[model samples]
Target: MKIHLTSVLVDDQAAALHFYTEVLGFLKKHDVPLGEQDRWLTVVSPEEPGGTELLLEPARHPAARTYRDALVEDGIPLAQFTVDDVAAEYERLSALGVRFTQKPLETGPVTTAVLDDTCGNLIQIASRPR
Candidate 1:
């Protein structure tokens, strides 16, 4: 079966939506109420709307809480995005007041950096050699 959906453990789905959409330039695709004050929300890339959807799910469940906590403790990233120019993208986003954890650094044929997604997530942006 094809993988239909993927999800991210967020502390607040609404805030995650804002960060992904407003800051990261994603567009909201689906938002439906799942429970009282709970929602099933997803965001997609504007340039590649059919590429993939990022589920903005809450981490109130025990398993999600543990996973997110462990990731944060280990200082690992929750997700990564491929870019054509890591430094340029980093500077563009930074000028928009985006906070980054690391600046672009070359690692072999790829240059990469990390940014605070503002949703309890570390997002890595990388530019790989062709």
Candidate 2:
């Protein structure tokens, strides 16, 4: 009935953490070491600390790597995050040296922009007229 957690495959968990937290403005919710080199890492939006968590899962699985690579090759975003204003967020992120695959594009009542996560995924930021 409700969503608790979701995941985005990351090539490097540490780098993903930095980008998701320092750049994307998410807060770390969970960080448990799973093995010698991997950890069960997750992050939540600062505005919604108790909301759904996003797992920065390692993309060690071959299938996951292939799937992510294909999506990137096609310039398709692997995940999307809602923001108050896509254009504003795009500007803020761009100032931080983030590379955007697609600039903010308005389509009807919604606006969206796609940016590389730096850890091997294209993430989209979107906003709808409110």
Write one digit per residue (lDDT tens) for candidate 1, span 37-106: 8898998888788877888988788787677667766667788888889989998899989988788889
Report, for every candidate in turn, its global Cα lDDT versus the true structure: 0.84, 0.95
Per-candidate TM-score against the hidden true structure: 0.89, 0.96
Candidate 2 wrong stretches, greater than 4 Å: none
The weakest ten consecutive residues by lDDT in model 2 span: 121-130
Flag clash pairs in model 2: none
lDDT of 2 by residue, 11-108 (tens): 99999999999999999999999989999999999999999999999999989988988999898999999999898899899999999999999888
